[model samples]
Target: MILSTASSSQANAAFWRFLATRLLVSLLTLLAVSFMIYGLIELMPGDYAERELFRKYSGTGVTITQAEIDRVRADLGLDRPFLVRYGEWLWNVVTRLDFGPAFRVETSVNALIGDKFFYTFVLVVGAMLISYIVAIPVGIWVASRKSGIGDGVVTLLSYLGLALPNFAIALVLLMLNAFVFDLDVTGLVSQEFRDAPWSMAKFLDFLGHAYIPLLVLGWSTTAFQLQTMRGLMKDEMGKLYVTAAQARGFSGWPMLIKYPARHAVMPIVSTIGFDFSRSFNELPIVASILVLGELGQELLLAFLDADQNTAAGILVCITSVIIAANFLSDLLVAALDPRVRMRGGR
Candidate 1:
């Protein structure tokens, strides 16, 4: 009993250390991503002040003089050294949850992003859940019945999903809704509920409109995950351990679930963060096509308008989410696979 207790304590210590290390790595990654995003924005062709002035006076036939642009830059503190501005922005973000201001909109970045991030978060997370929930069972089934008609059908669908761009999917769905269903499927909320205060009716209306984008986003993700799970299961099923288990009178669902299925799930869990990040990377174009007022759409507009602060703020938020997802994936993998914990500890 004493030896068992010591062993348990050592395992606990190792697990905690693993978690701490994973967290430190995630923080460092987030910092590097943020700095790179800010640096890239700084390196862009024109400053926000120049773009804003041109946008404000372009069609009105008013010349935006260099002096006027310089004065506006000074007012917005764009005249400060890049490092100094980044330091202040980073400090505010870390200390007070401030993301600075949106240069073009003349509003706090936090306020501008208020509900957009929430909507995008829901869509991305929902898509991920849909992918995994569908992938795991179907993958196992297809792997067990390889080369069958059902498997062939699924393979065809998965290929099509992977082959088609997300925007193409969105456009096809839009056309289908327009020609056949005649349904209102664009945006996160119906026209009436778009500006309405949050209530049960408004919430339900939002969900009604959200499903189109959700399905559009989830389509390719599900296909990719399904293929991954199918491949892994097939590989695990052919492994020596599985064959050994079969020789020991194990077969059918009981044997498959206990051995190969359990093992196959580890890689799936480990790649959840990558899947999530990929989905977010594809989101901007998809969201724009769907007319969804998510952070993805805002991000594209920010870049086009030379609104660096808004773009930086949105990129930082997305990067942070990706890092957090990766951290969670590590915890989950460690929990499910003792080998991972042992390796990390060592």
Candidate 2:
């Protein structure tokens, strides 16, 4: 009983330590991202409003008074020093979860999210799901058949797919859909229900158009994952333990399917998380190429116009999401590897 209680106490202590570590890491991530984002926003040539207000006629542009610009800057908290502005923004975000309004768009940050969050979410999730579905089986076959015709074919395809850019691939797919299939995916809808209300049917209709974008985003990364999975599996299959198992007549699909695949999942999971994070940030380029209704669309416009608020909002959100992805990856790694606690994972 005493030993058991001691063990329980140790477990509890470790749990708290783990939680504290995660909390500290999360706080550090937030600070780093905040500082980096603020710095980058500061570095961008000229202020958003300043550029816009001056673009038309320069000194004689809007005839805007210095007092008005100062007032506007103060109201936007732009006049404050970087540190002070950060503190103020941090306080608002922590207390209110408010990210202010977009400079380029006719909506609040929250309102923009409301208008487009579902579409982005669907696009990301669908891409991830399809990628995983395609990667795993192909990875297994390539690994099991390492250096055989199956592996050769998969390798060729993976390389070819990786060589193509996501935007180009998406553009081609879109053109084919429009020209070949006579699919009117040109404007985020079919003509049949372009005027329909926001409902499940309409949402699905939007998703139908979204599929091309998802595939474009997913295909290259999926090939990368498959190659990694194949390599990891191939390495594991050549291990002494696996060789011994095979010698013992335990050689079959079971060994490949069960043991090697299980071991291969570690790298695959980590890679998948990394890929997913990248896909979110990259959607902007794809959005521009495909004319998809997503935050990426806003991001492109933000950059073109040098709209600080809009660009910063998208950057902050994207950075936060990617940080969360990394956090989840750490948790997963810790969960998977007992050595993490004993040796301290990086």
Highest TM-score: which candidate? Answer: 1
Which residue pairs show backbone clashes in model 1?
Answer: none
Per-prediction TM-score: 0.92, 0.82
lDDT: which candidate is best?
1
Candidate 1 C-alpha RMSD relative to the actual structure: 2.2
Runs of candidate 2 exceeding 4 Å displacement = 1-19, 43-45, 55-64, 74-84, 146-149, 187-198, 247-253, 303-308, 341-346
lDDT, model 2: 0.72
lDDT of 1 by residue, 1-346 (tens): 9997887777878888888987898778877877887888788899888888887898998888889999999999999999999899989989998989887788999989978998888999999999889988899889988598999999999999899999999999999998899886878888888777789998998888888888889999899888988999999989999999999999988998889988898888989889999999888888878888889778877887767668878888888788888888888888777777656644
Residue 168 displacement (Å), model 2 = 2.4
Error of model 1, residue 257, in angstroms? 2.0
**Backbone N/Cα/C clashes per model:** 0, 0
Please state every model's RMSD to the true fold in angstroms: 2.2, 3.6
